[model samples]
Target chain A: MDQFDSVVQLLDSNGSVVANSQFTSTLSQSELLGFYRDMVLVRTLDEQATALQRQGELGLWAPLLGQEAAQIGSARAMQKQDFAFSTYREHGVAWCRGVDPVDMLRFWRGTMHQGWDANHYRDYGYQIIIGAHALHATGYAMGAQLAGRVGSGEAEKDQAVMAYFGDGAMSEGDVNEAFVFAASYQAPVVFFCQNNQWAISEPTRRQSRTPLAQRAVGFGIPGIRVDGNDVIACYEVTEHALHRARSGQGPTLIEAVTYRMGAHTTSDDPTKYQLFSDVELWRERDPIKRLKIYLQTKGILSAELETQLAGEASALAQRMRDECRELPDPKPSSMFDHVYADTDINLEKQRAEVEAILIQSMEN
Target chain B: MAQLSIVHAINQGLRRAMDSDSKILLMGEDIGKLGGVFRVTDGLQKDFGEERVIDSPLAESGIVGTAIGLALYGYRPVVEIQFDGFVFPAFDQIVVQLARMRYRSAGALTLPITIRMPYGGGIGSVEHHSESPEAYFAATPGLRVITCADSNDAYWMIQQAIASDDPVIFLEPKRRYWQKGEVNIEANMSDALNMYSAKVLTQGSDCTVIGYGPTVATCLQAARFAADDGVKLEVIDLRSLSPIDMSTLVESVNKTGRAVLVHEAPGTGGIGGELAARLSQACFYKLEAPVMRVTGYDVPYPPSRIEDDYLPDAERILDAVEKSMNY
Candidate 1:
């Protein structure tokens, strides 16, 4: 068997618990139920967003249909002080970070370039450029170290940074540079790569010959492969890496092996490139369904709990539908604002000229 | 006040800013013990320690990308690009991320970062070491592009760039690094000349000659040559490129009714082209001839032996000035 096949999995696809797993015994019943709820809610949000794009309400949407466990599990592992840097498709991560569902749509709706305060949520806004934010995350971790926030021996005081990227981003030079910097500086950062097996039309094989996690060994960091569809394993693996970072042991790379079950985006036709048979096979190992089955088998999920979750998901979807359409178009003059923190005389004059033209046109 | 070279003056400026603000950090390759390739960051690491004066890995993108992160974390980072030609590796981080962070965040985030790059040609150096890349950055909206010609401006402008809340691209004339001039260290930073405004280096009534960075010295030499010929030429140093001091240029051109722009970069898509277009529009009625340009040939920066022919010099500036004056 391939070394990549030996993923850290606590819950099998049939919903049976693996015996003698170090992490499985640590997770509480409440925590397991919480993960299930989060997975279901984010899936519903992803579906609603895709539908919105199809209905012409949004410019585009990158659906996170099957990678719910990978995103939510890793995000939930982060402490309050820890920061997260994500790609545009980490809507599940954003949900876990408490980003407003409507605010998340602003970027896709073309209402704003960025929709949330990155500092407030401890989540760096979506980075459209692949693998760019990894360096930013590494730098932020270095800052945390300079401020004496790492290896402080206090859970609430010490902090680590989480950098999220997909398998396609593995080929980018910036990402490799980020890894080099992180290792050289012993920066407190966890590199979480969700190997969704597809970089749009390209497969994982196109990006790397070996497992993506194995690349970390060349950078002198511990590499781990986790069953991305298993939320328990994903959470535990990320938690371990975050702990290592906080303790000043340096960075770790986590490759969550998952599949992208949806089109790359609303504009992409996955049927043109991807095999339907492969999609059918992945559907059987669905992240949410397996978690749901585990929760039912453990008797942690009740009829009342199911009803409550369904209602909450529908309400969240409704809120997204209502607020997405009602988003106000920004004023033309607002484009000139915040280009520079200080006064730029030339830019101000250009803004004034444009404003005058706009006023004259409106009067005519 | 003390006499200092442009290199030492910038070193003192960096020292002054780092002394005042604990959050200010210096990051680049060979910047710590090595004090940088030009020794501009000399004695900084020994005094401030390695934490503040970081010796980054020899990766331009990594240096810039990490600097942006440090700025996001509320530290003022001063990054050094070893050479002008090498800045392209970090160009995406500089242009896309560092420049647009504040605008993208709607003022919620401010990156008080200064990227110090020693630019322009004329020094005896190989390929990739001598190239003027200021035009690519000046055309970017969110960045503040400024350059220093002499020792005094180098002393004050570096500190000013570091203090600004927006990201600044500080271009230093590499050939003028060893050129000595007086620096008023006792002067108050607030009382210093406005960094965005252009200065009249030499007063004249004939054609106005404009240049910046390395070309400023050439323009001044040409003005002196023109004076020897009894054809007086006014010299103006364009300190800032992006938010150009057009008011000063327009006033000078209106007085002289002729202008000549000079730089080491290629003519097409250079700063000179933008200045010429703006000057032609601003001084159309007051002009005697078309606003002329004495820029480098639209070709790659040549080998060391032939760089003199490729670059704009005093004679080239004078030739353009003579053309404008006669026209």
Candidate 2:
């Protein structure tokens, strides 16, 4: 049996004030509205990408439909220097990292080789291999520790790494290994597992009978769970975790309890495995809608601002359609580049031979 | 200037690499104060300290996966997998992220990570200890696969691997780890023959025998036995697998018109199979006999008692060598 009792929620789902503990926030109306705005914008981008996939504009699409608050709230919670290693579905987090929407789309369209340039956004490319990036994130955090980037006198100066993987990925051996190393090395990083239930037809029950956060305690790292739909709870919890990491308090596992409102990808049919009622039950805790309602109650959202944001979102979606369709296919010859830093003589010969073959075929 | 075994040479190499580069780190299960099962990483933790020579959790994937992070932070990480068979756990990280990172990053990032594994069966070891899994990495792009045949090669090749900007899969012949040889630490043998070039361990104009790692010694010993019957056999040690030392091989096969590949790995889809196909393409016109392979049977590595039958010994290699020349 698992030991740590998951901090089930530091906040409630009803858009009401709940936790007034040390983790409680002191945010004003404008700041709260900004978080909501960011969430809504990222959701708009995700919806646009999904629509593009439906229209055959994307080769692949991993939807984060209901997990917006989990991603956005947590990403917004990170400081500027805090690095991130994310799985492919962290489009919301990528947006928060300031990645160009076009560069991100190019990856979905299968045109560009990589999703985002790390130098451009300071966010690593979307890692496709499941649970593998957790190790990379931990190692980087260890590197940060070695470089004297962590445990600095200044709290704001110290940096932490947030590694994003899902509940499905929690079962991966690498993720578990990462926990051991992170614990042993005292790496300054956060293991963020967005437990959005399904891992491609396999439910959370299939992954673990117990909650995923409880798995962290076995590794000697304290774990927590938050109401993933409640943006405020996610923000507060992620902030606290990041704070712990930066303060040289070692690694923490955050199991964001949420739901995947859409299919795993454009190729999946959720109806085949999951029930409609289960999906419907989670829709009430919609990440975007809860934030919108909260903003409305606080007199934070205006009709004019809403209309303007909607107009901008539609324009962005249309531009994605136009640009994604126009992104050029990578040149066949260019595949030979970047395999090795040097020419390696042998690869160059192979490249020449291939180019000759390609040219001969064209002539034929 | 001192003589050392392949295992000690490797230990010295690690000490030197870490001593030279502050960014260099070593991690594996029992590799710290316990000094690895083979003692290759012995005393490294004590000399370099725990931070540098780390004792990772007993998880191969985590070791390699975390090494990727160390690489990303400009650290040269050398990861030791306890055994070849255990490396499969980390195979996903190697193929998906480590191999493809530079290509995926478009050269903006490089994983100068070296994954060290003790491969090939001979010492009557139990299951899950003896495996020649280098073929998997050789098949995967963005990874350079190499194996050291002797102590001298072990001394220099490891440093070359460390200096390489790409991810390297370094498979050490565990059975030969204790075999002693003179190693000139000052000598730069990296460019001696060539990184990917096959070395002519023994020269013969009649037929060629190709092998790597532990099998090279066996092939050379077999050539000496074959020489008593006046069969002048040419032996080639394939130091690197992925970018095969084709020029030296093609030249030899073209002269001999007959060749045999040997290894402890299986016959089908083995390095021998790939080398045979490439030879067929490069030296087809020169062929007088079909290139044969003396390798372990096409099956999973059997029990330690049966391993002698599974491995390609001197007799098996000479058997193939004689048949090819007879053709």
Candidate 3:
């Protein structure tokens, strides 16, 4: 209805396009197949992680069961120099960024401070405080804009950022403040909200009266609602948004209308609140399945290639399951290391006390 | 040396830092147009333009969180958390993100962020305005906490604080913001006393009275009053609260065997307790008394009329000195 005139096509659950778009030619059969494979791999990893927690291997797991396309598609669309800030539920995006899926267990298992090395992937560590990273993305974008990093002629010279959060994060005071700051500064960044409808117990309806994307209009940035399960839709939207940012057009908020097909975390039981039928309805719209069907219909995927991909994905999942089970719990004294860079008397004293306790426990 | 207030001193430090580093930024509520409630950040927005001096929304957490991003991008952001009471809202961002960012990155990333909070009581304002929250940060790991007793210390210490590569929680004594002193504007910022070392403001043979921020003035006054009573009191200003200036404290406690620690924060788990424990270990042999303390009672800072009772006054400090001397 808005800007990307022919861009917002709603692909039906049966792999038939109910509406069409001019950007369809922008994607090739190989890219479409690649996106599907990534989604399937992520979904497989999410399932394995959930089972790992249930089997007492991990302390917790945030299953990105349904929002795989929104994360993987957008993550693959960006240039390497462009940075990313993600909330806790961006495992799929982390996978696209080349973060070891097993490393994420280190944080949930309380074995490490963060999932992976931040600089390794330019993935600024996963933020637990909802929407706090949104502002960081805004600030970094403003910094990039100032250094003449935006519209630098060379594609590598243009740097923008993408901030990912959920519907629950939209209600946070910091997220709204990020909107204000981004708008005022006209910082080149994309505020990507995977509106998966539930903030633990609360739904998206409770967080916003209008749609989450519509709120971006108030910030003077363009907003769009995309078919989140549609991998092509997510990639096209994110790529175009990044282009606008690099062109110094400022921020854009994309509300990927997806669904959470699994529990919020290993500790949460969605059965306590949400209806099971809703999950079933969304499962039919599984991002991987739609893409697979589209690929199969287009004769882009052969049974042999699909079997090989699934086998590889399954083997990777098994290795993750095995590695997570054998992963060592952190040494108790290591907790003091990250508290401060310089030696602190109070922390040293506390560490000594903790060491004494842990040693005593070991003797028992 | 031109005389300037602590407010002006901090203003000079900010101006100098911004002039030195193009990446240095100043942000907070009313820090832009209205300067600041205390005018410590006054004239910054006008001098540096809006990008360098930002007037943010009323959310403290947002200010600190975004500041972390700015720091990650190689900008040194100096934030003003209007008052002590308002710091709690940003405690999550400051402690969890800003404080932990450097360590989380394993020294790969630098968070040269300075959080300037106008702290301590005594300006006779409404509730939540005059509270001593330094101990909270002092207990928090990964944060370097520091405060100044006077304008000279404020001018040099603030620049030193901003220049540090680590995140610093800089506490400004609101009550003493208007106190005037000689601040050599031309003096090298790092030439003053070491940031981690405490200073012996006054020397005496009787007892050591330790305090910082607004309480340093009160402690000095108490020392003077004690002198009238024939009690020669030594005063120590703890400039750095976290990596505490223990050497100066140990030296003084050993010289003056009897010691009295003072602060406006509650008596329990106060900086006084931490100092007492350290000095106890460091100067146990020289002690003439089980170190005494004069501090606010373990209760919320009360109304202005009752704040006299809640905050340790010079009389109470002298009383503690007498008690320690008696022991």
Candidate 4:
């Protein structure tokens, strides 16, 4: 109960606001409702993507069923100028960053290498290599500091970076190196970890003896453990961390205690190792249901508002389904298009050779 | 014009690159106050200040990974891995992130990062210090692998590599760092051979010998010895390993009808094999015999006591040349 005992919670599992949290004054009712809508929309997108994978439309799907609050809350807390580097499982964060839902399916559909332009969204696309982008984010933050775009008094002008990884990434050398550089340089970056219990069947405890947040203390970084299922709690912690980073206080490691409610991906069968009781236990702490209960208790979730939110979610899911099904196969020659900034001489030679082979095949 | 060692030439080149572009940065372990393990970045931190010339932590992967980020942020970071063998720790970042980022982003982003490592086996100090890891990098796409054998090329190519938009793996012959030569500071890149082109250091009609990095000097020495034996061996310095100057090599092999590939790295699966295969294919009809290679044996770099035998020297190159000429 050391750090987790002090876990910041604005809303509990009972759908009642904790008497002491400051979000009651900071967040407006409309903003609270927006969080609920985003969670529902992202969850719907996740479900639709899973179904599409099952129907052989996608290569695989990594469901974000139980960690919506952690992703959406931190993402919504970010300003447009701030950059985010996320893992492959961060569909909710991508949604909050205003990425088109259909674009998210491009990688799994094998339609494109990356789903979207990182520069356009100010969000680096999902990094498949575990913990590599954590170093990238730290370097970007350091560059921001050196460029005078961060640590300035003006909040809007000071761009910070959020590097999101799972609990499993903590074990990677790149992540540890990122921690060292971020701490030593005091870079304007936040290491956001969604400790969703399992890293494809390996539990968080297997990676660490102490809490994940406590590991940051060894790096001389401030650490915070928050209930990742609590949207307000995640938002508050992330907001405070982002502020600290922008103001030149250095990096903070925030561990969001969450769970994955589905299989690791469409390719995995979690029942082989995970217990049913554990899954049922986390079902009680469903982030979406708890938020809906709070909205209903506050009388802000009217029948018409619920219908509108449900309609919006359905529309998003339908669009994802349609776009995924319509994604065309990439042109064969396009494979050599972007291996380098300028086409390499060898690649150019190979491209011409492949083109000649195709021409011959067509002629034959 | 000044007489400078390959190490000093590189230091001057780094200074010139940073002076020309404020975005150019130098980072590595002990590069700042300690200059570097080889002093290639010596006095750079003093002249440019610490911000531009950084002293990174001991982690090789961190240096490369963060350099990628810095590149994204518009800084052309030139990272140094202290030695050749130590680079494997950063192999993931170099192979996966550095080589694939530009392609993965579909040309939206470019990593103008130059990774400098003192490579090759000659000065046998200990394990990990003496190694030739160029073939691994040459095999990777989206990366440009180049090595400089002389001070003149070292003074210019380091700057050129830093200026390229694509990521460049710049390998320096650690053993030849102190070899001195005349460097014309005012000379432009056009005055020298292009970074990717192979230059014929010595021309002969009897046989063609190809080498890069430290082995280029050995091949030159072998040509000198072969000349004494009345066997004229044409020596070609392969500046770029990947996307090799095959046209030049093919033309030379076509004329000579015999070729010998030389390097300090192991013979099996080495850059020599690639050169041998390409030369064989390109000069199939013109070849007097199969292309031969003189390289280190297929084993881990041995102890310093017998490094002379393990490394390809003038005798080995001449022996391979004699075999090619006889065949």
Candidate 5:
């Protein structure tokens, strides 16, 4: 299929609702406004986090500048029981899942390996290793299938698993293996590949020869490409895929065609590899801006609502800045905790010896 | 009590665990119908049904990676790696994901997963078939690396490892699969010896000869030889590799005043080296001689024809014992 022609779009780049689109007419005004609010809040968080990293408050930060629609849209499509496995850049997804922004900063702020309780948020935290959690999502989906949580006929009872990865992760062995397993087992999972066009210094072309969505077809799963910058398209596509999964139709691959408008991380220099013209072009297709325009055109985004959202975003940013610095350093002995669930005699001795030395040093 | 081979004992142990826990899953390549390459899981798939016993695709990483997910979803998954050398593909998942999940989650997540792989040399198999890669995992902190040396331990420790909240690297001595011993089938799991405690098979005072997995029988034979020479050798099976059971080793060495470690893995950077270091430190004052180790040479596993020379046998253990005795 032609990459451009096959893309499932609900709204065009200029915020005009696409004519004859199957998904555009189904969206509710409240859901649109909620998506707009989520995108704005996470975008604000992204900017503030980047600034914090530059000011030495955080060790590093992965900025989710342009892919707001893809993360927020897909994350908002899930039910309460559905679980999501995400890469580190899914800050918007985490925000939509009710993770406290302060808790999200714990890892980037160097306080802990994991910031939030994964079980609490139904988000499997941030998987640092590339594409590894794809298999985990597939496995969890398989577990859900075995537990009779799929094809239960009740939307409240049936569950699906979402796996979030970037275009760069398309080349990983684990991701391909996950696809094979998910297809073979007919697992209830949706593999969401946010094709943000770049993986650090490498382009999407470096990772795959064809459109990533089409690659899923080889694994016997339906593959769809969507206008990732358009929040309506992302949500509709993700919802459809998740619905199929919950109904025991097996896995679907949704490639959200987007761009990484910012550097890979705080440490990266995008200027070294990407073109300024490319960045300026993607800037026009901004996810939040298009959604805002669509809301404004539909007479849903009033001046009062805009002002309220702006105030909420600023308040959230302020809270994050205050909490990031105030996050306390962990005790030295905390490192020895949670290595194993059982009492290890050798670890106990090491902990005791270290404790004794600390006490002696303090006494001296 | 019934006499059974190590393979049958492990199979029985898996059956028992699966019978009690409805959420227990068995997943691996060819483990379902083929019953594993060594038939350790024979007839399990037919009895447990396909949902509980899965015959996975030929991908080690997929098997382990998916097992981690199953564990996350509140199922106890027992994954089998087809061979020792084939486990490298899944090493990242085993070491990084499975091992560190609990610690990384700060105890919020617990993976009650057991990874069973047959390891060690002596069956005169191909290069990848016979390998002792236990040290690499034993060095990792969040893992419980334990191996069963005989039928009785195989029967009980498989259940114990399955019941553990932490991830366990359950290594089976491949060459000793057919070795038969009487397993106490009616005994309770609570009454059995701790999986981490080293067992003193035979009591002696002159030297503590320690081995685990495939080499435990070799140590016993070496002890018998030492007895013929009028020397009493205390034979101890170092079952748990990660925790090392240092207290048991220390106690035995404290009494024997000499220690000789044995293994099929290379001596350099192996479990033998770690044991020697710890034993020397703990028994510094009580030691009559330096701790000696009889192990494979530092090289890739050789051809099947020359494996006997490469593997640690009774003669080699005796040589190490004599060296400690002469000192």
Candidate 6:
């Protein structure tokens, strides 16, 4: 467990550089600023989504309140061809993948299960079944290996796959099976675990006696632990892992040590189980706050820039709210669509029967 | 046309499908080298190479969940579950993930996956090897459950299932794997009846006997025995269990005025129960008696010594026919 102990961090909580950092020289000032901006934007989106849920605009919302860097940094590390399988809470990752915030709300509003086409963004939609997508990512990586799209010497020609899950998901059978298959096949995939401290009222300790990253060694896969609040560390580690996967070095396990500042979901009440002190302790290591501090200390953040970003976030949130309100009600017949690539005669008959019953009820 | 066992026919069907499509791959435990416990996949690995005919690790969920990923990546993966009872470990992946992906994605993704499992009893296997789990899969909304009674359908349906855009649960009767029948190698894909349709194996006028998978042969035998007793019985092989070819069943029941449903699964809440209820409603005016079902008792499959007694045989089916005639 201690082999990967040193949590790779380029920036400390107080916005000071750690002298022996590997990513400090690699990341440019503008790119660092961009990371900071993206983190703040995602945090703002999280807050708005939570507020919408409270007001009944959404059925539920899983807030990515404190794990912005873990999601954004790793998501930004992927090449255009690389694919990601995400759990439902990775709103930060979705934002980084260029999925419009409003489009993500359709599912929460009960309009549809998936709000966007996975093919359009090269990223799978939110997988609600915990840890299931890990196997999917491993299998997709195997497919890439078979297609001669993986293990190429050139990075551009190689495609790597990534799966995002919470610490709780490490205990799931699907995730464990994924580890076995990924390692045995030497699949070109990365298992990104955001150890966000709490899974509904249960802490990470309840799920594992050892750190999650150490579990990778048993599967014969290399594991890396990083300070999730440090955006630079997250980006650097993810880029290195993805490069290894692309170059056919096989899979990597990344455990991003982070905290969730809010309830697990809109319906959850963290005050019932977690201590306020614990939340306060994590508040000091806020991913967005640390990056903002780093940008300010570097003379990259100005008063005018802060005001402009705040305005942009508010405008985007407002547009999302308006669009969500105007979303059309679901049609009963639409359920019959897409059940199969080609609907058979029996399904068509059932659909018609349902339509007739619905029409009869409406007329009466 | 040539005489072949159901096992060899399936092997030929698999080989033909793989030969035609580069994206078709096979994965299962012991399927590559050992040629499956049933040897249904014999020589496939040698002919197709280990890459295409992969011998997967011994995790059922891993087999199915990874197959989902492979399907998403544009490969039509045909996974063998080894046996009927072992499929439970993969039940979550099949019921929750593979069955729901296309509907959840709203057509954004299609899983052309074929999960083949040797099902049912009478070969005297150990515990957890003889369960007929067709009802559980047929109850699932997004899946297509299919079973074959002869070498011809076994050969054709395996290829059709691989060609289908939807996920299919292809159930093979383990006890009937060696049943010999004629297989037409020249049959065209477009000409064969859609795999979902039922087949009237024998025509008669006195009564209708409906069965699928393992019980189809029993019903055919019952019909042959009924012939000597001055009673002609119509035997219908329900090829597809889910979107059950109701038209054929309704027509048969309409003409016969009585129908007998047979299955090896437990009687209560079985496919027989569902078909009996539906046929009663569909053939209400034409029926002479209640739709009768000759099924295994609502109990766990017993020891191999009494396996014939546990499973519905020609006698039990004939008894049901006699009871229906009296009604």
TM-score of chain A of each: 0.98, 0.94, 0.94, 0.97, 0.97, 0.97
DockQ, candidate 2, comes to: 0.02
Q: Stretches of candidate 1 above 4 Å error? A: A1-5, A20-22, B1-327
lDDT string for model 1 (A1-364, tens) is 7655578988878887775344664679899899999999999999999998888777678888899999988999999999999998999898889999898887776656678999999999777666889999999999999999999999899999999999977877889989999999999999999999877656787578889999999999888899899898899889999999999999999999999999877866777558899999999989988888888987899989999999999999998999899987666555556767788776566457446646765796
TM-score of each: 0.57, 0.57, 0.56, 0.57, 0.57, 0.57
The docking category that best describes candidate 5 is incorrect
Task: Summing lDDT over every window of 10 consecutive residues in candidate 1 chain B, give the lowest-scoring window.
Answer: B298-307
For A105-145, candidate 5 gives per-residue lDDT tens digits of: 87777666688999998999887666889999999999999
Clashes per candidate, residues 3 or more apart or on different chains: 0, 0, 0, 0, 0, 0
Clashing pairs in 4: none
- Model 3 has an lDDT value of 0.82
Supply candidate 5's per-residue lDDT for A106: 76
Question: Clashing residue pairs, candidate 6?
Answer: none
Instruction: Give the Å error, residue A133, model 3.
Output: 0.3
- Quote the chain B TM-score of every prediction: 0.99, 0.97, 0.98, 0.98, 0.99, 0.99
lDDT of 1 by residue, B150-208 (tens): 99999999999999998999999999999999999999999889899999998989999
Query: What value does DockQ give for candidate 3?
Result: 0.02
True contacts kept of 6: 0.00
**Which 10-residue window in model 6 chain A sums to the lowest lDDT?**
A328-337
User: A41, model 5: CA deviation in Å?
Assistant: 0.2
lDDT rank, highest first?
1, 5, 6, 4, 3, 2
Measured against the true two-chain complex, the DockQ scores of the candidates, in the order shown, are 0.02, 0.02, 0.02, 0.02, 0.02, 0.02
Please write out the lDDT profile of model 2 over residues A39-115, one tens digit for every residue. 77777788888888788777668899999889987898899889989988999889889986777887667554475
Per-residue lDDT over A1-364 for candidate 4, one digit per residue giving the tens place of the 0 to 100 score: 4754576678888787886543443778899999999999889999999999889887677899899999998998899999999988999999999999898888766566577999999889877666889999999999999999877889789988999999877877889999999999999999999999876655676567888899999999999888899998898889989998998898999999999999877766677547899999899988988989988988988999999988988888888888888877665455556656875776566457446646755796
Question: Which residues of candidate 2, in runs, are more than 4 Å off?
Answer: A1-11, A20-22, A361-364, B1-327
